[model samples]
Target chain A: MIFDDVTAVWNQFNLTERTIEHLWMFSIALTISVILGIILGIILYQHKKYAEPALNGLNALETFPDMALLVLLIPVAGIGEVPTIIACIIYSLLPVTRNTYTGLVSVRPEILEAGTAIGLTEADIVRNIRIPVSLPMIAGGIRIAIVFTMGIVTLGGIIGAGGLGAPLQTGIVLLLPDVIIVTGLWVGILAVIFDGCAGMIEKRLTVRYGEW
Target chain B: MTSIHPFETIDRIELSHLTKTYGDVTAVSDVSLDVIGGELLVLIGGSGSGKTTTLRMVNRLIEPDSGIVRINGTDIREFDEVRLRRNIGYVIQQIGLFSHMNVGDNIGLIPKIEGWGKEQIDARVHELLEMVDLPPEIFSARYPRELSGGQQQRVGLARALVMNPSLFLMDEPFGALDPILRKQLQEEFLTIKYDIGRTIIFVTHDIDEAFKLGDRICIMHEGELVQIGTPEELIFHPETDQVAHLVDANRKYRHIETFTVHDLMSPLSKREFYEANMPVSEAMAKILSDETGIAVVMEGNNLRGTTSRQNIVRNRKKNLLLGDITTEPITVTPEDALVPVLQKMKTKNASSALVINREGEVTGMLIPDSVLFHII
Candidate 1:
C-alpha cells in the first residue's frame, strides 16, 4: 500500500526532474563558493591587518536569517535559480573562506621558518607548505559548505526554482500527506547523502595531510 | 657539485658592528667577525647569548639594526635575501622537514625549485641521502613523522646539503638528540665536513660540542662576542674569566687527555715477575699477593705473556703451564695519552698493560685503578 502511494506521489510531483535540478543547483553554488572562498581567504591572509574586520563582516552575513537571505536576493537577482544559487553561495562563504584563512594562517611556525631559511620565495612557501598543510582544514570548510549549499538549494523551490522543495511546498499548501512525506523524506535523505560523501572526503584529506 | 661551490672563488664573510635590538632588549650587539673561506667556525654560548641572532644576520634572515654583513666581499643587502639563502645551506635543531612531503622530495626541493629536471633532481636527492646515511630505496617514500628523531635530522641535513650550497649555517642541528645519537651525528658531521664543508657558521650552546667539531669557536655571552679561538687556544689562553669558566667547567678530564702514558705508568722493574716455567699454583699465589694482582711472565729478560689473578684462578684446576694460561699483554709507548691507553686496556679486556719504550724493552706497567680515580 505504502509503495503504491510513494510511486503515485513520485510521478505526480516529477521527482526525477526535481532531483536533477536540486543537485544541479547544489553543484554550481558549491563550486562558486569554494573558488571564491579560497580566493577571499588568500586575500585576507596576505593582508592580515584587514582579516579581523572582514571576517567579522562575513560573520554578520552568516547570522542573517537564511529565509531572509533568499528573500533579499530576489530583489537583486529576481525569482528562479539565479537568486537561489546566489543565496547558497552567500551562506557558504563564511565557512569556506574562514576555514581557508584559518588553515593558511595556522601552519606551524617552524615549518614556515624552515621554508624561509631554505630560500623559498614567498609564493613558493604559500603554495608548497602552507596550502598542503592546510588541506584538512580546507576540506573541513568545504564539507560545511556542502550542507549549507544543499539546504539553500532545496529552499529555492519556494521561489519557483522547481526542485523537491516545490513539491514539499505544494504538499504543505494542499495538506497532501503522501506528497509531504515522500518529498520531505527524499530531500532530507539527499542532503544527508551529500553531507556524508563530503564527510568521507574530509576524513581522507585529514589522514593524508593532518599534522600529528 | 657547483651547488656546493660558493658564489665566488672565496666566500669570506665579514660582519662589522652588527647589532639587533628588539624594543628594549638587545639580541646581538656590535658583533664583528671575519669567517675565513671554507672554515667551519662555530658560534657557541648559552641560550640568549646572541649566537643564533648573529647567524641569522649573515643570510639576512634577521636584519641587523645597524652594521654591515659582507659575503664574498659584497654587501649582503646588495643581493636578494631569497637568492642569498638559496646559495647557503641551513639546518636547525627542530629539523623542520615538511610533514606532507616524503624524504626524497624534502631533499629534492631545492633542485626542483632551481628548475632542474625530474630525473636529475631525483638522482641528486638520492646522492645527498647517501651522504647522510639514509638508504634511498627505503627512506625516499617515508614521511617525516614515520622516522625517528635522529633520522629526521639526517633528512634535514640531506635537504640542506642536496643543493650543495658553499656556505652552511647549522643552528644546534643535533641538539634535540640524546647524547649517544648526538655524538654519532657529530662524528658523521666531521666526516661530511672533510668531504664538502665550505664556510660554515655552526651555532651551539654546548661547549663540549664546540670543542669537538669546531676548527675555531666564537663564544658569545649576553649579546656580545666574548672570545674567538681554537680549542687549544681557548683552553690555554682564554682572554676572559667568563670564557675560561665556560671551557674549564667541562675540561677536568682534558688534563688527562694532555698527559702521556709516562705520566701515569709505573717502573716495569717493580712489576711482579714470574718465570714461564713456574708452577701455576705459585704464579697464582704471587699474582694474588701483588697490588696489581698481575704477573709479567719473563723468559730471561725477554717478555713472555701476562696473567692476572682472574686468569690464573679460572685455569687453577687445569694443571696447565703458566705460559699456557697467560695472554698477550697490551704494549704502548710512554708518550701515549692515558685515555687512549685506558681504552686499549678496556677493549682488550686487560686490567693492566705493559708500557714499552722505542727500544721495544718493557719499561713500565699501566694499572686502570689509577685512571678510574681521574674520572671519579
Candidate 2:
C-alpha cells in the first residue's frame, strides 16, 4: 500500500520548489560558514598562540548536536530557516576552519623564503603566495563543510522551514509511509547531488592549484 | 678570466666592521671588505667560518649586531630593507622555487612586483628562460614538480636574475646538484658572470670552486678573515702557514719571472719548431715530450731559437746553453742554493737548470747528472 502511495505522494509534491529551498539553505549557510572559517583560520595561522583555544572552541562546536544548536537558537532568533541556517553554519565551521589553518601554516619554509626573496610585499605574499598555495587544502575543507551543511539543512524542515524534510517530518507524525519514503528519497538524492558538485569543484581547484 | 671594465673598479659593496653573534656564538666577527663593481668576490671557509653570515648582511637578510653595509657608497640601512633586497639577487643551494607557480610565473614574479607591464614581463620571462637554457615554449606552463633538479636550479637562477639586480649573493648555488651537473652549471654560470657584469658575493666551502670562479678569493677562518687575494698571490705569497696550507695544492710551483726567448733559448735549428715567446716551463715541457726531443723556437712563424735536450747533457762548458741539457732544464737565478735549486728542479719536473742573471741572460747550466758525477 505504501509503495503504491509513494508514487501518489510524489505526484502531489512540488519536487522542484522543495529542492530549490534545500539547496538555497545549504549554499547560503555554506558560503557564510566558509567566509567566517577562512577569516578565523587565517587569524589562527598568523597567531599560533591563539590556535589552541580557537581550535578547541571549534572542536567543542562540533560536539554540540546540530538539532540542539537549532533549538538553542530558537529562544533568541526564534524558529524557521534563520535558526536552521545558523545551526548549519555553526556545524559546518569545524572542517573548513581546521583545514584552512593547517594548510596555511604548513606551507614549506623554503617556499616562504623564495616569496620574500623575490621582493613580494607582505600583502602580495599572503594573497598571491600563501593563499594560492593553500587553496586546494582550503577547498578540501569547503567540500567537507558542503556535505555536512547539506545534512543539517534537512533538519530545517522540522521548524516549518520549507524543504523536502517538511513532508518527511509530517509523514512521521501522520503515520504515513509514502510521504516518509518519498521525501527521504528526495533528501538522499539532493545530498548526493550537492556532495558530488562540491567534490567536482574541489577536484578542479586541486588540479589548478597544483601540489607542492 | 673575464676582464672586468676598468672604469667600474670602484667598490660596489662595502662591509665595514661587521659582527654578528647568536647567543654567545659569533657567526661573523668584525669583518670589513670591499667588493669591486663587476667582480665576483668568493667567500670561502669551513662551516661556522662566517662566510654565509657575512654575505647575508650585504642584503640585510641578517642584520649585523654592529657594522655598516654600504652599497655603491650609500648606507643600505638608509634604504628600506625590502627595496635593498629587491636590488640584490639571491640564489641558494636549495633552489626555493615556488612549487605552485609555473616556470614563467616563477621567473617573472620579481619583475611583475616591480610594476613591469604584462607584455614586458612576459617577454622578459621568455628571455630569462632562454638565458638559463630552458626553452620557454615548452617550459613556461610546466610546474616545478615536472622539472629535474638541475632544471629547477636554472629556474631559480633565472628568477633571481629577472629583475636584473646590480648585486648577486649566491650561497653554494650549485652545491645541491650532482658533481657532473654542478661542474656543468659552474662553467655555464662563469660565462653568464662575464655577460652580466654584476658584482657578486659567492659563498662556497669548496676551495677549488672558490679558485675557479672568484676574481679574488676571501678566505675566512673561525669568524675571521685569514687573507684575501687573487688565486696566484694566495698561492705564491701566502700571508701565513694557514693561508699556505689552504692553497697548498698550488704552493709548490714558484712563479718564475717572465724571461725573453733570447735569454733562455739558443738560436733556431731546422728541426720541429715551437713559439719563441711561450713560457719556458711550457716550452720546455713540450720539447722534452716531442718526438725528436728538440724544438726550433719561432717568433711570428720565423725561426728564432733552437733547444735540444741531448746537447746540454754532452756539453760541459761553463757557458753551456739551456739547449744543451739532456733533460728539460728548470729556469732559476744563480742566487738560489743547491738544495733549494734541486728541490725546485724536482718540483718543476725538470732535471737541470738554466742559471740566469737579473737581466734574464743565461749565465750557465746546472745539469743533475754532472752534479751527481762530480759529487761521487
Candidate 3:
C-alpha cells in the first residue's frame, strides 16, 4: 500500500525532472568550489603570514546560516539557481581551502630538504613534490564539499530552483503529510547516493597518494 | 660519459676564514682548511661544533657571514648556486629519497632537470645503480619504502653520484644504519672512493667513522677549527687538549691497531688441554672449578674446539661427549693484526679466538678478557 502511495506521489510531482535539476546544481557548484579552493589554498600557503587570519575568515562564513546565505545572495544575484549555487560555493570553501593549505604546508621537513638539496626550484618543488603528495588531503576536502553541495541544492527547490525540496514545500503549505514524507525521504536517499560516489573517488585518491 | 665537463675541472677546494653566527651563537669560526684533489677529507666534531655548518657553506646552503670558499682556485660565489649544487653530490643521514618516486626516477631527476636526453638519462641511471649494487631491472621500479634501510641508503648514494660530480658533501651518511650495515657500507664506500677519484668532504660526529674513511681528518670544537691532519698525525701529535681527547677516545685500544695477535694473546702453554671424548658431567665439574672456566678440547692435539662453564652447564644431565657441547672458535694467525681480529670477534660475537702460528701450531689464546680491556 505504501509503495503504491509513493508511486502516486512521484508521478503527480514529476520527481524525475526534479532529480535532474538537483544534480545540475550540485555538479556546477562543486566544480567551481574545487578550482577556487585549490587556488586560494596555494595563495595562502605562499603568504603564510595571512594563512591563519584568512582561514578564520572562511570559518566565520561557515557559521552563517545556510538558508540565510541563499536569502542574502538573492538581493544581489536575484532568486533561483544563481543565488542557490553561490550559497553552496560560499559554504563549501572553508573545508576545501583549509585542507588544501594544510596539505601544502604539512609536508615533512626532510622531504622539503631533499627537494632543495637536489636542486629543485621553489616552484618545481611545490608542483612535483608537495602537490602530488597532497592528493589525498585535497580529495578529502572535496568529499566534504560534495556533502555541502548536495544539502544546498536540496534547499534550492524552496527558492524556485525546482528540486525535490519544492514538493516538500508544496506539501508543507497544503498540510499534505503523504507528499511531504515522500519528497523528504527521496531527497535523503539522493544525498546518500551522492555521498557514496564522492567517498569512492576519495578512496581511490588516498590509495595513490596517501602514505607519502 | 657525461656531456657536462664542470666536474672534470674543479677538484681542489680551499676554505679561507669561514665564520657563521646565528643571533648570539657562532656556529663556525675562522675555519680555514685545504682539501686536496681526489682525497676524502673528514670533518669531525661533537654536536654544536660547527662541522656541518662549515660543509654547508661550501655548497652555499648556508652562506658564511664572512669567508671565501674557492674550488679549483675560483671563488664559489662566481658560480650560480643552483647549478653548483646540481654538479656536487650530496648525501645525508636520513637517506631522503622522494617517497612518490621509484628508485630509477629518483636518481634520474637530477639529470632530467639538467635536460639530459632520455636515453642518456636511462643509461646513466643504470650505471649508477649498478655501481651502488642495486641492479636497474629489479630495483629501478620499486618504491623506496619497499627497500630495507641499508638498501635505501645505497639508493641514496647512487642518486648523489648520478651526476659524477668532482665533489661530494656527505653529512653523517651512515650514522643511522645498524652497526653491521654501517660497517659494510663503509667498506663499500672505501672501495668506491678509490675508483671515483673526486674531492670529498665528509661530516660525522662519530670518531671511528672519521678515522676509517678520512685521508686526512679535520677536528672542530666550540665553533673553532682545532687541527687538520692525517689519522696518524692527529693520533700521534694532537695540537690541542681537545684534539688530544677527541682522537684519544680510542687510544685505550691504540695498541690494537699497532700490535698483532702475537703481541697480545696469552700463550696456549699456560692452559691445560682436555681430550674431546671427555664426558659432559666431568667437563662441567672441571670447567666450573677451574680458574679460567674454559676447557680446550683437543682431538689428538688438533685443537678441535673449546667449551666454557656456560656451555657445559646446559648438558650436565645428558651423557654427551665434551665435543658435543663444545662450540667452534674463530682461528687467527699470530701475524694477523689485532684490528682485523677485533672485527672477527665482533662479527661472530665470539668470546675469544685461537691465535695459530705457522707450522700448524696453536701457540696462544686471544681471549676477549685480555683484548676487550683495551677495547672497552
Q: What C-alpha lDDT, on a 0 to 100 scale, does residue B158 get in candidate 3?
A: 93
Q: Which lDDT tens digits does candidate 3 get at residues B236-303?
A: 68888788787664555655568778876877663457778989877755653353546778888597
Q: Would you estimate the TM-scores of all the predictions?
A: 0.79, 0.74, 0.79
Fnat of candidate 1 is 0.71
Task: Indicate the DockQ of the complex predicted as candidate 2.
Answer: 0.40
State interface RMSD in Å for all models.
Answer: 0.8, 1.5, 1.5
- Which residue ranges in model 1 land beyond 4 Å of their true spot? B1-11, B249-251, B254-376
DockQ of 3: 0.44
lDDT of 2 by residue, B134-203 (tens): 6577678889888877778888999898867778899999888765456556766877888888888999
> Candidates' lDDT values, in order?
0.83, 0.74, 0.82
Worst 10 residues of 1 chain B by lDDT: B367-376
lDDT of 2 at B245: 82
Q: Write the per-residue lDDT of candidate 1 for residues A123-201, one digit (tens) a residue.
A: 9999899998888899899999998888888888888888787998898889998898999899889889988888998
Assess the local accuracy of residue B253 in candidate 3 as a C-alpha lDDT between 0 and 100: 63
**Per-residue error (Å), model 3, residue A58:** 1.6
What are the C-alpha RMSDs, in order, of all predicted structures?
A: 12.8, 15.8, 10.8
Q: What is the lDDT of residue A189 in candidate 3?
A: 88
Give the range where candidate 2 chain B is weakest over 10 consecutive residues by summed lDDT.
B1-10
Candidate 1 CAPRI level: medium
Candidate 1 lDDT, tens digit per residue, B228-318?
9887778777898888787773455556668888887778564567788887866755654353446788887777888765567556657
